[model samples]
Target: MNNTLLPAVDTNLVPVYAEIFLLIAASAILLIDLYLKGSRRNVTYYLSLLAVVGCAVLTFGDFNSGATVYTFNGMYVSDPMSNLLKLFTYVAVALTLVYSRQYVTDRGMLSGNLGGEFYVLALFAMLGQMIMISGNSMLSVYLGLELMSLSLYALVALRRDHATSTEAAMKYFILGALASGFMLYGISMIYGATGSLNIPDIAASAASGAADPTILVFGLVFMVSGMAFKLGAAPFHMWAPDVYQGSPTAVTLLLGGAPKLAAFAIVMRLLVEALPSLAYDWQQMLLVLAVLSLAIGNLTAIAQTNLKRMLAYSTIAQMGFVLLGMMAGVVGDDTSNMPAAYSAAMYSSITYVLTTLGSFGIIMMLARAGFEAEQIADFKGLGRRSPWFALVMTVLMFSLAGVPPMMGFMAKWAVLQAVANTGAVWLAVVAVMFSLIGAFYYLRVVKTMWFDEAVDTSPIVTPTDMRVALSLNGVAVVVLGLIPGALLGACLQAIEMTLRS
Candidate 1:
């Protein structure tokens, strides 16, 4: 290999260091689980927690540092965006481990894999996301995306004997492969047009007026399509509901939680950094997808009787709101397009992930062996059984519906304002309409819990660890909503960093 093609040998390797810590912890957990038995298995949980904490520490330790360092030519970079993404990834995965232990163990999802596979897979997925956030080249992006997706393919099917879990995994695998293929093809097209795979070079080529518009636009479409699939937007969201419904509750929690942070990072890289020149075309494409996702996600969710499935569609709609923020950032008619739009979009993404994680945490609380805790009916009179859980779910549902005094409401408001600032009045109207449609389902869940008669069966609540984690998970949602300054501030900083860099 040519020496010139390699990345800088000495640079801020803190990001890589975080991955190493996680790898070592994961391997150690696997070995310990293999040799140990019974209650000792729980040690893997603490090890995973340690891994996340270590990663978080590294993230902050490397804060505010910016370098366009290249390892393997221009394949990777340690920049502001990557740093911000890793921080969020750490938080999300940590919360997943905290809330998921009881759910996974009780459901038998921890069998045959040293009881630490979920944590290991989640860490690897985070590693993949880290790679994508730092990716400066097409090769890096594909590697990161595959690393994340492969782990998820197995994760969704964690309960191998469960028919729905197997089906969900199969669907996700096939669809994910197709999306990756599209992205790869688009990368090739972009390279053909620009004669380079490095993102900065592609942007420079476009700036120099040497790039072909046709090929670039074609590549942009394919790239956006793949991202849309990742974001679970309309027309590309066919897999989300099934996957969410089929996977174990803990897996659903993981699926919805931290990955969105990585997805946003990927979007920022591909659309905001690499293809800003094609904003008009992609903006229009995103506009249509946003409207469709909002409309379909909300309207269909109202008719769904399954809680996980409902949340699955709700997630799709939330992505629409995110798209609105992104469109405003890139194509708004407003004078201050860069930071204002970016801040709004990013803040929305951050808050959405937090709220979604908390929402899934409620689902995990009710999950136990021989009981999926997925259907809406299962929540009937839940208030009588567990008032605290009901309250937490209420907060999650209302926030998702954009009710005021909650972070989700603020997130929606910020994006809607950005959209209106861009003079996209119709898009804003669609968002409002969909919000109401979504509220119906959310409200139904609350009503079923508080007003409906209690079912005779009591949910299994064996694990002491889960009960404690679930309690915190519920409390965290309200706490985050009521005091969201730090999180929002971090998101704003992330936007500034990425744009300025």
Candidate 2:
């Protein structure tokens, strides 16, 4: 009776090699950091960078293969979209660490009790993002979201002694918890309706009309509400501005950059993959969110004097365009336009993250110990302070404003085109009008930088690494805008492959 053999697990570790390696690397670095003295903190930083590079190396094959491979009992997937997004996540995390090094160090975030936690937590956060990007099941996506959110919460509160930082972290944690609860409840309802947590199974059930429509729609509403909170789309964007403005600039960058990609990935997985049958319902919801986000984000940004707060509002507006692209994917039960529409959303998210990195990098570079350059007036006469960085900042601002020959313009145009292609010409027109209104604030920043007199003309000193990285960041925006074909083509191919598989 005891001689019965258990069935062997059918598991492939190859698909998760990057995640395994990163988890090991982060743990090793955390332990290694405990032994290193203050001066040796750079070792931990380099190790984290090496870990990111290793992830890229491991994921490169998957990206090139252009094949979809599922593992972890179909909870995780390795596909062109996941691989491409993971690669970009690696780049974003690496650049974030590089840009944050001096900023964190100057504020003692890298020394004393904290000692290298910034880098360690960032790696952990990246691990979460990778999981989110590859998640093929609702449970896996939720797990990844919590991991990333927890790490970011700690990062925001890193400056524990600072009242604003502590308060901001608390606010973020509370709202984040609420969003997670909403998502969890939605998942439960969906599982009850469809009898599955597997995304593809849910999709098949929904497509077959085998699930309870009333419960499904209710769950979908809750799910979309949670996602909107995560994406900083309005009506659910109360936490973004305060969190953005209150966290340290370095932490603010951490909150803004790669996580957006992960958020977008999961949105696609849940809405496009799991609930395509409810396309009209969710599209209407997205339409409302897009309009509200555009209106609130643009109009509110005009009144913001704090640069971080303004950018937070700007992020909301940018996400509005992304929502537009997302909503246009399946127009009137015809999914012929899905690939182009979704790819455009993907491109908008990627480009927005690229531009956001440079914008925050400049803010950090301008800040010194005990002085955060967070005010709009802080940029007064910045062009005279350091012409190159000022020009870099200008490029970044132009990109955010969706001005011509910058990456943002291309991103906006792509989304608008996607919307119009769906016969939503009026929606596209509204978005453009909001874009025009948003441009005023961005141009005002430029005006302050070039035309205003200096308040504190101290030399703009920056680390060489940051200088070079920022330069490349700015150049990438302009270059990508001018020759947008390659990235856009890649996005389209990735989306096409993902949907086909």
Using lDDT, give the best candidate's number: 2
Identify the runs in model 1 with alpha carbons over 4 angstroms from their true place. Answer: 1-12, 64-73, 332-335, 457-465
Q: What is the C-alpha lDDT of each candidate?
A: 0.80, 0.94
lDDT of 2 by residue, 397-441 (tens): 999999999999999999999999989799899999999999999
Q: Candidate 2: where are CA atoms >4 Å away?
A: 1-8
Per TM-score, the best of the predicted structures is 2
353-436 per-residue lDDT for model 1 (tens digits) = 877887787777776667667888888888988887788788878888888777788888878888887777888887898888
Every model: Cα RMSD to truth:
2.5, 1.1
Task: Score candidate 2 by TM-score against the native.
Answer: 0.98
lDDT of 2 at 106: 92
Reference-based TM-score, model 1? 0.93
User: Model 1: which residue pairs collide?
Assistant: 6-73, 7-70, 7-71, 7-72, 7-73
